[model samples]
Target: MHADADIPTEIQRTLTEFLDVQEQRLAELGPELAEQVQAARDATSGGKRLRPSFCYWGFRAAGGDPERPILTAAASLEMLHVSALVHDDVMDSSDTRRGAPAAHKRFEALQRARSEASGSGGDPVSFGIGAAILLGDLCLIWADEMLHTSGFDAAALARASKFFDAVRVEVTAGQYLDLVAQASGTSDLDLALRVLRYKAATYTVERPLHIGAALGGADQHLIDALSAYGLPLGEAFQLRDDLLGVFGDPAVTGKPAGDDLREGKRTVLVAHAVDHASPAQLAEFERLFGRAELDDDEIQLLREILQDSRSVQACEDLISERTAEAMEALDRSPVQDETSRKALADLAIAATSRHL
Candidate 1:
């Protein structure tokens, strides 16, 4: 459970170099688009670049060079992630992200300022949302372009492209399931776990590792082994994120406390709480969940109930189990490189560790 700040020196060096290259590439799009890219890049700052690190090490594990195509692909994956976050903030109506004003909100404020100066007679919020959406789309397009132009061999390109496409489809399907679960009040734990696999696990860890491996010319056996390790590690990562959404310190997580409660996300933790809640607790949750007007006191009470009901403990136990499975999978992997294996193991620890 070491802090992400305590990442191994080589991994940290690789990430810093990767980010520098990304920044330089971002600057190549000219001043106007570069500002947009910079804004998007700002969204990524001040958090664990866990996914890219996974991809980088995955490449190393498969005997891939981290300097060119592999690192470029990892950067593109991060851009895709940034695009998703921008849209997610808009869809969730979140006012803050990364301890700052959400992109859409920031754009809205800028739009209003411009509109007021020019006496424009249009909806500023709508204008801002539209701008943000286009910005996200631009980032997505750039992500694809980054990967496409990396100049890998035909076979490697084909494999990586297939992985990328599958990742996109799975994430979208997971998002659909999430929306459906929210609208229908289904919240089945199995269904939630499925969403976790598609939405977070595969895209975040498994496919990234596979893509890196495929680009590096790894065989099917190695790819399958990485998937085994990645799946549980990815789930553990998201589960920890869900916990942070509710219980994390705002200063550390860069979001308001009880944000998941406010958004009414049907995370595994929430699902467990609902399943184990007493009648009175259920009533209280029914009254409070998804209410825009819920006060801090209500949020605090819900937190207490979640802790009291032992759902948090259950979630912690699940995280521990998943992390252990990830380690076991890694141990069984045929990746013989000592540095790569240690990096992967360290990544697994960093992914699920509570210290962030």
Candidate 2:
């Protein structure tokens, strides 16, 4: 795990250098662009760096050189993740991220200050949304630029590009699926699981692993092996996240308590709750589950319902089961590097851990 710990440091370093270059280019355009670039910086800073870690360790497991320029390529995934987060926050109307104002909120404040100083009538909220959308698009573009300019030879970049493209398409499609699920208000466990698998699971773990493995020139057999280990672990990762969304400490999660409930996220845990809740509990849940203005007492009641219905326990059991499956796969994986194997195994635990 000590070796794995350096992955975030390496990713941060790569991102910092890349962003500095981006800032310099933006500065050449005008001072007006400075704030936007800073907003991108703010959004990108400070995260678990899970995607890059998975990418790095995947490359390692496939016998890539330790000194290879993989960090630059891996850091691109972080940029893509930042893009998703910015858009996601706007979609959820989230006010904060990482304990700070979300990108859209920050832009809204800027819009308000400028509007007041200039004595102009403007819709700050709309401007904020539009600007944040553009920022997300910019980060999406930067992800591609970073990977293409990562100093990897054309052959390696070509090998990795397919997975990179697939991840972007799959994640975007998954987001749409999530939007559909929420809009339809369907409690279908199948729909919820579909959203979970496509929206977060593959992009979070499998594709990143595949990209790194491809970069390492791994064969199809090894690639399939990584998928066996990555998919279940990825689902467990999101399941843990769903639990944390409801019960995790705000300070630890960097979001307000029960934000997911407020946002009406159609998570697997919630789906399970709907399935298992008693008639009275179900009615109460239907009333209060997605209400935006739910008070503490209401939140507590929902929590009680979830607990009483054994939804929490069910999710925990799934996490344990999925994690065990991932570990078993990893144990029998064809990866020859002992350190990388251990690191991947450790990552599965960390990702699925109860801690926020």
Candidate 3:
């Protein structure tokens, strides 16, 4: 591990400049719409800004200008990400995000204030969740509108629109697979990898690069090469995320310790543990897995079991292997620009190696 800030200072500066324009554009709406947009903007605070940075560099790597439309598109993608977080927090019933109150929780507080003024008998949590859902929908629509309204010609707009559509479908499918895996208790490694590809790989890395490259008129060969690099990196990133969910410090991660354990996520770590646990250990796991009443002691025991079984080491090894694969893909790709290739490689390393 390395931090993203340590990778490339100039790219970070370019990303900040792009965010300024995006913030201005987000503000240039009707008063009520502006308020909604502002709420969405507020939700974006303290993120890694990884997606937008990916989109920006993807564009630059493909020789696209970081001008108005490109910036707008990148910002719009960020807004879409914010929208996803809002809904995800609601679904996960998560109270905190990025070291602050979740958006739905923020809205619930607003709902409580409004109810107090009106003496209304309404559930603030439900109201807040409903409102956040609607807001997310609005952001998704606005993201499309922003992309469409960018000064690109009809042909370019169509291509970009197609890319966005594919991204949306793939991400949705990934989410569905995640929910299904959680519900069905299926921990097959192959199934887990499939979910990883849809949920993290394509949307997080591959499609972002493809969308930017397509907008920049990149040919199919370059797009394929980028996908080859992005897919493994994205998988490695998700696997790292899964590890953090179980083992990371709550203070740094801004999430509950053992939250994934409580949620019973069928991540690769869990799958490995299940495969390796002895009958006695499996009995303990069966008793504790997905139980809402599991206590800190139980969680600690489960963690110890995972450690004793070497599941953690297995995940670490997998991450290293995937990183090597990603680097190989990047090295073998036909990307001509040394700077862009190095930046992308550095980002892949940073993304997978992040601790929080």
Candidate 4:
């Protein structure tokens, strides 16, 4: 979703400063440690800044001051997002992310170069995975340090941290659920939605909003209202992502076509197709859907089957419905800031309307 694209210029500046400080501090350790920090900086550098934007707007909607500490607090979400993506690539065994070789792939290639230079006898692939895993963990730890040192008072930081802690735990648990779904090949639509709720929605929107609202000293009523707006919008966000994973151009989306299918993702789109397809189409889907050998032709065949079963339109309808619901929730929210509320409305459209 790279570089705070849609909103909040200040948030991006704060994030960059925070990372610079992190790099300088890490440099005290050793050059190798600095290299790893550089990897983290590289990984963290660009993104749509979806989480930070949501948090910022949420803080604004609750009438929180446009201040540095809160912005720093919001920027922490970027590191959290980096952690998620790095680990997710490793878990999915994905080849690329945002048009670059994935973190693990980047490290694997580094291992290869070092091996060639030193004539080492280690396994590059394993070394890459190990390094990437540690990098992801470091990103998580860095996010915590950023939050703790964001210059908020203890009471305010604690308030935001409640949501922050819960968000990390929820998303990680959701990740495990998603991995389980992939391994078991569970195609049940309800289970898929559950996984979506835990894995993507909370991290993407809901908790970001909650964290911001908490910092803004929102009442429970306001928090609940924001959750109402965030969750449905968050679902629409992930559903759009699923559609893009299958249908988006590699040139723009930065991953190969059919990458999700290659990973055997049990998306609601695929689950809906499973429910509605004809026997012949189902047969074809099962044959090629999760196979490692899926070629372009097979991928096309799968796309066609999904279309024939009307899953594409069904998913679109869900996105439209959820978007409307999120807007309605925003309308009902007790937020007094008309400008920020309007921005949130625009953000809802941006989240669901883009082809990226």
TM-score of each: 0.90, 0.97, 0.88, 0.96
lDDT of 3: 0.76
Clashes of 4: 4
Report model 2's TM-score to 2 decimal places: 0.97
> What does candidate 4's lDDT look like per residue over 1-356, in tens digits?
12234455666677678778877887888767765776886887667788988888887877787644676778788889999999999998999999899999999999899999998858999989999999999989988987899887898888998999999999999999898888886588988999989998888999999998888788899899999999999999999999999999998788999999888999999999999999999988988888867899889999999899999999999999999999999998898888788879988998899784
Q: Tell me the tens digit of each residue's lDDT in model 3 across 49-77.
A: 66666766676677775553665666556
Looking at model 2, report the run of 10 residues with the lowest lDDT sum.
1-10
Q: What local lDDT score does residue 198 receive in model 3, on the 0 to 100 scale? A: 89
* Candidate 3 off by > 4 Å: 1-35
Q: Distance (Å) between predicted and true CA of 327, model 2?
A: 0.5
Expressed as tens digits, the lDDT of each residue in 1-356 for candidate 1 is 12222333433343345446656776776655554655665665656767667777777788886555565666667777777878888888888888898888877887788889999857879977887888788778867876787667777888888888888788878888887767766457887788888889998999889878878788999999999999999999899988888889898887888888888888888888888989899888877887766788999899988898898899889899999999999999999888889889978877888652
Give all candidates' CA lDDT scores. 0.79, 0.90, 0.76, 0.87
Model 2 has an lDDT value of 0.90
- What candidate 2 gets wrong by more than 4 Å, as runs, is 1-5
Best by TM-score: 2
**Residue 34, model 3, lDDT:** 53
Pairs of colliding residues, candidate 2: none
